[model samples]
Target: MIRDWEKILLVYEQAVEELKIKFKSIRKEYRNTDEYSPIEFVTGRVKKISSIIEKAKKRNISIDSIEDGIEDIAGIRIMCQLVDDIHRVVSLIRDRDGKDLKIVEERDYINNMKESGYRSYHIIIKYPVHTAFGAKEILAEIQIRTLAMNFWATIEHSLNYKFKHNIPKDIKERLKTAADAAFLLDMEMSAIRDEIMDAQQIFQAKSTIVAKILRNIQYLYFSGKIEEIEDIRDRFFDLNEEGDINRLKEFNNYLEKLMDKYNIRKLI
Candidate 1:
């Protein structure tokens, strides 16, 4: 009979390798550009594999057959950056094509929560994993979450694990309140991200103009003496700070009038 620890270690290693292969295959099939967290999947599988091995030890079950009925962590949680992204990734996961890929169950905790719970997606998949000894079908769990949602869940999970699901009432209440706060935090961050991206685009547009003006001035400086190049430089600084396209166009028109009156193109 294999020792309990040996069985657990062997299964854990096998599961980890199989999960890596499975993730790679899915990623290629979906053409996913984002990075995935394999550590979360491995950690969860280890816990489940250990539990199953412990039970097998207790039952005096000597499994000569590789097909032992074990269903613990056949679920995977996939965390995404946004609610929309979560849905997109879920669609990809659902459409994965492989002989071993089978979706046994699915849960969208983000939408199905009783309270203001944060968002995450989960899938329970049964994939046939071949071990060193023989071919065995094992269930795997996948979970997906946004970064903020993941942070909250990790803390909550630690609390539950520490207390063995018998946490104090006050702590439990505080945890729920914290979960609510995390939900609000995600929404606030999403809004802030959109605002910042919009602002960045505006900055990029203005900076492009400023760069072109500066380069032109630099090029003209080497050729000949222009009295108003200093004025052009000053205008560049002004437009940079204003970041207004209309104001920049007006300034450009003024510079053009000055250049025409002075016949500055002949100098260039």
Candidate 2:
């Protein structure tokens, strides 16, 4: 194993990038098909070298065993809009067909939360890192949680940092209460999940259609098709007012055809 921390970090960077891309690709697949995606957003990071060394020291891990002992040097966080979506995201990750991406372990704290009142699902995966020496298996972590849980956890993290991880008893009790409140909020949201999802889907569809129309109009305007712009805009306003997605789609297709009929001189 190489002792160069920079080279090791490059591998972590690649692992983070690959996982983020995979998760985002799944999100795109759902969005393109007009379906609900469990993934609200995906983010990743490589743990700081200082944090790594401290954790390793605490665990009494020797330098040679750091690669296997520290699983979260490369980390990914997946956020969801609802609690149920957390499980869905986990399933998606587990079903991934990558020959290199293999789930090694999962720690479910949501069902049986931590004594500190933390609630999240942790996933550890073995990812193959290709180097000049050949492919080597590296461990990475994926954390999944709802938006509300994230808010609570983020605040607790900040407080822990502020007090050097020795939070006062009163503050700890209050944090426990806040975690309960966050859980209640997630449960309430789950109660109206269907309605919320339906509204979100409608909004996404409308936004996508409007964006397409505006893009086509911009191209048409650049192509000296200003004459078509005003009429399309008027119709767009009418259909949007009526919430007519079918008509909006038709208008988008019509505009695309008009934009394609640019047989005139190039403005640029």
The lDDT, on a scale of 0 to 1, for candidate 1 is: 0.61
Per-residue lDDT, model 1, residue 184, is: 80
The alpha-carbon root-mean-square deviation between model 1 and the true structure, to one decimal in Å, is 10.5
Candidates in order have lDDT scores of: 0.61, 0.87
What is the TM-score (0 to 1) of candidate 2? 0.89
lDDT (Cα, tens digit) per residue for candidate 1, span 1-268: 4546556446545665666666556644432322332222222444454555565576665553222444443334444445555666667667873655777788778877644354567776776667678776566667776667888888877887799767788887887788778778767766775664456456655655556566566655554556667777887787768778768766666656655665766666
Each model's TM-score, in the order given? 0.54, 0.89
Off by over 4 Å in 2: 256-268
Model 1 clash number: 18
Clashing pairs counted in every model: 18, 0
Top candidate on TM-score is: 2
